[model samples]
Target chain A: MLDLLRLLSFGPDGWGDEIAQGALLTIELALATLPVGIAIGLMIALAKDSSSAILRGLGNLYTTIFRGLPELLTLFIVYYGGQMLLTELAEHFVEGAHVEVNQFVAGVVALGLVLGAFSSEVLLAAIRAVPKGQKEAAAALGLSGWRTFRLVTFPQLWRVALPGLSNNWMVLLKDTSLVSVIAISDLMRQTAIAVGVTKQPFFFYLVACLIYLVFSGASSVVFGKLEDRAARGFKRVGGH
Target chain B: MELLHAIGDGFLSVVGHLGLNTELMERYGPRFLDGVWVTLKLVGISVFLGALLALPLAVARVEGGKFLSRLAFGYSYFFRGTPLLAQTFLVYYGAGQFREQLTDIGLWWFFRDAFNCAVFTFTLNTAAYQSEILRGGIQSLPAGQVEAAFSLGLSRFLAYRKVVLPQAIAIGLRPLGNELILMIKSSAIASVITVYDLMGVTRLAFSRSYDMEVYLWAAVLYLLMVEVVRRVWDVLERRLNRHLLISR
Candidate 1:
């Protein structure tokens, strides 16, 4: 019913460019943060597995705090809290030195931290899914820890963990839109701005929804295919 | 010392303003409590409604009815795929665009109330998520159980309600609890549209105090609420699953 082309014009007045850029930023933010999340997740799983009581406590506390809080609210804390910390750091680290984490950097860190907390659980499960016998057998063979982990543990861990990690990635992607709150100009925020300028809340918001749907929809298919590829080894060799 | 002094002053201002606290208590304290009551009412109603709506959609996915199933699949795809904030804004502000036609048909009354709007949007959002979990849980059920139920002359409804639903509940509780946590957080979004829960109080406090600390206090309130809710839900889930003797 509404004129769709005029609604999405790439011109200065047309939000086409901003919305498109927002979509790109959302994807990039998610992709950039996945490694941080995965790495932190691995460390968390390790900590949870550690014999040290303090390590176990820290691991438990990390997941409990991050997972317990709301993502939207957490974004606010990071945007503000991270600024306070960096400013506090600047006073000590550099004489009259100033370093600022912009909204985008703060966003990536905040979202990734949250993602890391959730991803840790999935990683813990994945790591455990690797058989105990393999570790024991590797120890019996007198292989060094690094070789045993690299050769035996991680390969299977990746296979067991790929689906969950990808699922976390999709969530990370969608939640990046939340950072638009601190005015990172990501897709949803950009769409809201476009709606404000165009005086067409309905049209712009609907378009934003469609954009998210398309992105996540494509990701689901891709993730499913990846899972299938990961499982292909088992299929060919006969069932686990 | 200056920052510490500023913090001390902020604490003093908050504490010394007994009149402010008293005034807030006098004016909207009941209303705030009512808001909490309404939120509980909303979360309870929406979760149940969401679960109910999810069941048919989940069953359709598992059953694979041609046209209707495809329609359900599309519904889940569209709803689950979109962000909840986008949906909230669309329902509250975007739906206002069609008020004239909606009013002409007398549907305006339902849409006019912010609470109804919140419940409706929240129900749809949670329904989509819950349905996927339900579908997965149901699929996880042993096929032989269905056969055994049928072998005992149980009808589909009885078999599902007694056999399938119980197991699905146990399987689905964690995800469902996660959804409930999400619903609590998302309720704060409703404050943007004039349904004051907690953040609404933050706005009011900021206007009066003109301080960022008001928002800070609000954030602490939210953090505390989330922590309490998390512990409570963890206990409830553990209680529910005690029959299985599995440690979560």
Candidate 2:
């Protein structure tokens, strides 16, 4: 036990600091991707809900393509394909300018696109679950469309969307491990490096798994509380 | 073989019309086909084996005694809570840490192969997800269905085999399809451990030519596979639930 502690300790002889940094980077990547994914998902949801057939078709196409493709494949496309495209643009516009897509940015965009595709489904369901009469009542009160959505629809959307979105967040948290493939020093990659040096693959990988479990377990608790808070002031209709 | 050749020619002609690089396709096309076969074998074997393991685990979760239920719960929870990639690493590389003990047990050969490790890890991982799906399907049935089976002079095992499982499976078909699709996508991670699935071939092809089009082709192939599965699953679901449909 003491040997294990020393191996995981934060000093020249140990890998604790590197693993800690990797854990922080993993959290940072997930946090950075959250708003981008949610915003894109919201737009896609609205697009699917729109009256225009073109907009609806485009939304369906986006979700179908992104959700169908593997997340690793998406990452490769963004990392390599995005770099290729940017380099071409840069060379064309500015004489001999070089461009390399940042790994962190590529990870965020790739994972965000995937999360958007999935969350749109959840968000679209929640948007539809809001009673249509609420909007009509708001309109009858002379409220503008935006005001009606803000005052009446948005509040209830959270209550309905929270559980599905929480599930997505857990998935996103796990998917962040894939970014380690693109040479980002996320927790998984850091642990891999530690395993390489220490020759203790089981120890390091098991530790990595435990860290991830802690994050996910904490997330479940936090989301549970959020669901409760969202449910406050709403009357229970049927079951206990 | 002649029919396959004809299909290949037709595909090449389509690629030509699309103005894609035909030379790249000509060189890497066979490799990609091989990759597809590998991917299919990986997902197919693992999902089938996983489902087998899952049925019992699901039964344990929903119908077994307290000790069995808790054991199943812990197994499912551990696999579900962590990233599959991490689980893969733990199994693949962690095997090295136990080389001596495994050698003594004469099981080192199994862990020594990357493909075997991938299959084993994927089997365990998908079993957890599948068990949860099965549990949900089982629990979702109205309680009276089971009671009716018992009241019909059917034994406990007979009731489950003849009545409960069929209904649970029918209810769970869509989710099982979704799970299969997810497994197809997740199988790509096996490439990181050197399994040469579709993604592995794409990576190798990319390193050689550095052409972005290879990834595009891969994306198209994956999309086609997912679309095919989705359509087939839709038809199957309808067929299975035909009795549930209201008559026009």
Candidate 3:
């Protein structure tokens, strides 16, 4: 146990600082990906719910492809394929300039694409769950389409979308581990390094697991509070 | 005419580059097929084993006493809260740390093989998710249905066996299908531990060729597998819910 503590302790011999840094990277990666993902999800939800057939088909295809593929496979494709594409383009346009995709960018883009896919499905369902009459009522009040959506639909949509989106967020947090495979210095990658140095895979992995549990456990509480806040003006019929 | 020829040449060059990987495919084609087979076996066995384990645990969660319910809850909570990749690493590597003790108990052989470790980890992980889905399905049933079973002179166990389980299974079919799909996707993580599944083969092929086409081919295969699963599940869902379908 003393040996374990020393190995994890902060110093030249310890991986404590590296692991701490990795944890922060994981947080940063997830946060950076969230808004982009949510924005794409919102657009997709709108597209799927829109009256246009072409937009709906495109939205469905995007979700199906992303959600259906394994996240790791998606990451690999994004990282490697993006690099190849960029290199090709650079070679064609620039005489001798080289292009590269860093792991951070690759991780964010891949994860955000996937996040958008899953969250769009959730958001689409949430949008449908909002009563149709509410929109008509907004229009009856002489509210324009954009104003009605902003004032009425979007606010209610979040409440309806909260639980599913929260689940997606939890999943996104854990799925960030896949980025470690690409040599990203995320929590999982850092733990892998620690395991390599300390020859204590079990100890370091257990620590990683605990760190993840803390993140998820805290997120659950935070989401629960947000859910309660979203439901503040609503009444529960059976007190469920 | 010049612009048209340039456009044609550009398209042909792109195709030529992508198509030039025939040698890579020829060399790794059999290996890729073998990897797919291994992946299928891993998913099949783990999901089967997981469902078998989950049923009783789900029952315990929904109907058993405080101790059993809490035990079930704790298992699911821990497994669900952590990343599957971490759990895989813990099992694959962490188990190695206790080789002596495990060997003493004659369990080292299970942990020694990456395939076994993967199956074991995936089984436990899927079981946790499956148990929760089952518990939810059971809870979702109208209370009167179970009461109706009891009122028909069925004992509690018989009531569950005769009435509750069948109905819960029906309601649980879709979520259970979703679980299976998730398990299939997650089985790729086994590659990280050198299991040589599809992703593992892709990694090996890429190491040799450094061509991105290998990953593309692998992704296409994965997409194909997912599509089949989705289609099959849709058919199954319709068949299961046939009685519940409303007439237009």
Candidate 4:
């Protein structure tokens, strides 16, 4: 036990610092992807909800492709394919130019695209669940479409969407580990490095698992609190 | 034969128009086929074994005494709480740390193979998820159904086998299909451990040709597989629930 503690300690002989930094990066990657993902999700939801057939088809196509493909494949495409596309565009515009996609940014974009695809489904459902009469009432009160959505629909939409969004958040948090495959030095990769040096794969990998469990467990608690807060003004139905 | 040849050529032309580089397909086509076979075998075996393991555990969670229920809950909680990649790594690489003990116990051979490790890890992971789905299915049945079965003079085992399980499975069919889809997507991670699944072969092709199109092709193949499964699941669900369907 003492030996294990020393091995994971923060001093010179330990790999604690490296693992800690990796954990921080994992959280950072998930946090950075959250808003980008939600924004894309909102856009797709609106597009699907729109009257234009073309936009609706495009929205469905986007979600179907992204959600169907494996997250790792999406990451590879965004990392390698995005670089190729960007380089071609850059060279076309400038006489001589090169662009390299950052691993972190690639991670964010790929994960965001996937999360957006899924969350759009949730957001679309929530948007539809809002009473049509609410929008009509807002219009009767002289509210514009955007204003009605903002002042009347948005709050209720989030309350309904929160549970599904929270599930997506958990998935995103776990999916961030895939970025380690592209050498981002995320928590999984950091643990791999530690295992390599210490020749203690079991210990280090178990440590990584515990760290992930802690994050997920804490996330569940926090989301539970948020759900309660979201339900503050509502009456419980069916004794739930 | 001549008509078939013409159709093939037209297909090639369309693929070329889509910028898929038919020449690369010619070179790597057989290898990709092998990769698909391996991926299918890996996922098929794991999900099959996982469902087998999950049924009893799900029963334990839903109907077992307190100790068994808690034991099953802890297992599900740990597996579901962590990333599958971490679980795979822990099994694959961690086996090395136990080489001597495993060798002494005569189990080293099983742990030594990458494919075996991948299958083992995936089986455990999917079993956890499947148990939760099954547990939900079992619980969602009205309490009166089980009580009615008891009143009919059925034993506990008969009640479950003849009455409860069929309905629970029917209710859980959609989520079970979703879980299967999720498994297919996640089984790509087996490539990370050198299991040579579709993604693994794509990685190899990419390294050799430096072409990004192989990934696109792989993505298309994955999408097709997902679509086919979704459709099949839909048909199966309809067939199973035909009695519940309202006549027009």
Clashing pairs in 2: none
Q: What TM-score number comes out for model 3?
A: 0.92
lDDT of 1 at B26: 42
Model 1 DockQ, alpha carbons vs. true complex: 0.42
List DockQ, one per candidate, in order.
0.42, 0.88, 0.72, 0.89
Q: Which lDDT tens digits does candidate 4 get at residues A30-147?
A: 9999999999999999999999999999999999999899999999999999998999999999977888999999999999999999999999999998999999999999999899
The digit string of per-residue lDDT tens for model 1 on B94-207 reads 767789988999998988887788888889988999998888889999999889999999999899888987898789888888888878777766665677666565556555
Q: What are the runs in model 4 whose C-alpha is more than 4 Å off?
A: A93-96, A144-147, A238-240, B1-19
Interface Cα RMSD of candidate 2: 0.6
Off by over 4 Å in 3: A144-146, B1-20, B246-248
Ranking by lDDT: 2, 4, 3, 1
TM-score of each: 0.83, 0.96, 0.92, 0.95
Q: Would you list the C-alpha lDDT of every candidate in the order shown?
A: 0.79, 0.94, 0.91, 0.93
Q: Candidate 2: which docking quality band?
A: high
lDDT of 3 by residue, B153-213 (tens): 9998998888898888888999899999888889999999999999899999998889888
Count of clashes in candidate 4: 0
User: Where is the poorest 10-residue window by lDDT in model 4 chain B?
Assistant: B239-248
